[model samples]
Target: MVYENGKAWEKIVKWFGYKLHLIVDATYELPIMYSLTKASESDIKEGHRMLERMEEKQAEILKRAETMVANRGYDDTKLIIKCWDKYRIKPVNDIRNLWRDGEKTRLLTNYKNVAYNYKGNVYCYCPETGT
Candidate 1:
């Protein structure tokens, strides 16, 4: 089978290979489940797929699990909500810097006393030394 496998650019090296997504237990730090896909496959989608696979392959573990902690890559509202509404698992994913606690913009390009939210909201500051 031929597919459009993705490319990865890391630092100064550019290469083409598959992406491996792994899920591990928080305490034991051991592998739980994993899936390989094209480099272009998104982290959130792959992560969700891994979760669904767990539902079938490891129902016992899923039943005892309470939260799925993920990095900012899976910091999607819809996915988080779905994890809660569908599986009753709380997604403890961290939002990107754009949504950092009461912080500024995503890019923070040449702007001061100005902050932007993920949902297209803007915050204005008085510039009075952390106001």
Candidate 2:
């Protein structure tokens, strides 16, 4: 039994097994890479491992990749930076709301009337109305 903590909703899940992590091409619906890890492993960790392995075993695929889309489970800053800085691939992972004190939607810059939410959705507020 694993007690998942530090989440908005916590629960004790009765699970004991391995998990299959797959890097799939969304357009073609094909599998690019795969690995099996213990259930306790984190999605971010597995994502990093898969990218590292791809660099060594399948550099061509990584070079041709444009974006890495993933679920909220893999919403990690280090992993996102790794994909962009090393491989130049834009990460489109769903983000978790990690803001404190119930904050939401921060201004992108003081000069611009643009703001973005935790999920990376940009909003352009009207300067006159400030909506």
Candidate 3:
């Protein structure tokens, strides 16, 4: 689990009606990993701190794996993120209606510059037309 600003707090309020956060580290497959849970305290209030915690866990796991595979000179590891959503949450009707109207414009404007450059390159490379 990862916490983003007040998102976790909001989730706690919405779900369990609490306002706390927790950071948990555990060993899985002989390596350490971490997760976040919201409660009544603020364990991670900033994104950067949460990122640091993640990096710390990753480094610990890497060091442990390296030590275990010292003789082989190589090791393989995989990290996974698992999320559990209990409530069937949906956007409000008004928001959904407004989103349907504005989504295309938002998406188009967001990608317009990138798409223009790509299309320019495509047309520049036309073999028959010799653009």
Candidate 4:
């Protein structure tokens, strides 16, 4: 697995372990599915793979899911697009903050007050967008 899976994230952490990823039904609060992978894995890829598994193993529940929420770690454009395109499930993954010279900053500085909302409706809030 090391040759195909492990990746050197940095110098100190010689990671050769696995990570557990899971998804749950928001309403029922029951676990839906889980996956284990090498620690050097990408969360976005794992997320999609988990959904694909759900499509095969739990098609009924997967079909009914309207929205999916995840942290910034799972933030990927392709994942977001695929969630809607393949399953009609909206992805509400938190976006990482943009940076300026290694300093964290909002993506759109002009709209300082414009907040990004992922609670249910996945979109940014602005007067023009009718938020």
lDDT of 4: 0.78
| Tens-digit per-residue lDDT, 18-131, candidate 4 | 988979887888888988899998888898888888999999998999999999988888888988998899988778754435632233556644443333333365666655
Q: Which stretches of candidate 3 lie over 4 Å from their true place?
A: 1-14, 17-32, 39-47, 60-101, 106-131
Candidate 1, residues 1-131, lDDT tens digits: the string is 33457655445545578888887888888888888888766888887788788889998887777888888988877789878987888888777666447744553467777777775677777778666
Model 4: which ten-residue window has the lowest total lDDT? Answer: 114-123
lDDT of 2 by residue, 2-98 (tens): 3466446446667599989999988999999999988888999999999999999999999999999898989999999999999999998888878
Off by over 4 Å in 4: 1-13, 98-100, 103-131
Greater TM-score among 1 and 2 belongs to: 2
Best by TM-score: 2
Candidate 2 stretches greater than 4 Å from native: 1-15, 99-117, 120-131
lDDT for position 36 in model 2: 97
Per-residue error (Å), model 4, residue 70? 0.5
lDDT of each: 0.78, 0.89, 0.30, 0.78
Task: Give the per-residue lDDT of model 3 (tens digit) for 6-79.
Answer: 44433333445443222233234433433355554343232234335655656453333311111111111111
Clashes of each: 0, 0, 5, 0
C-alpha-based local distance difference test score of model 1? 0.78
Best by lDDT: 2
- State, as a TM-score between 0 and 1, how close model 3 is to the true structure: 0.21
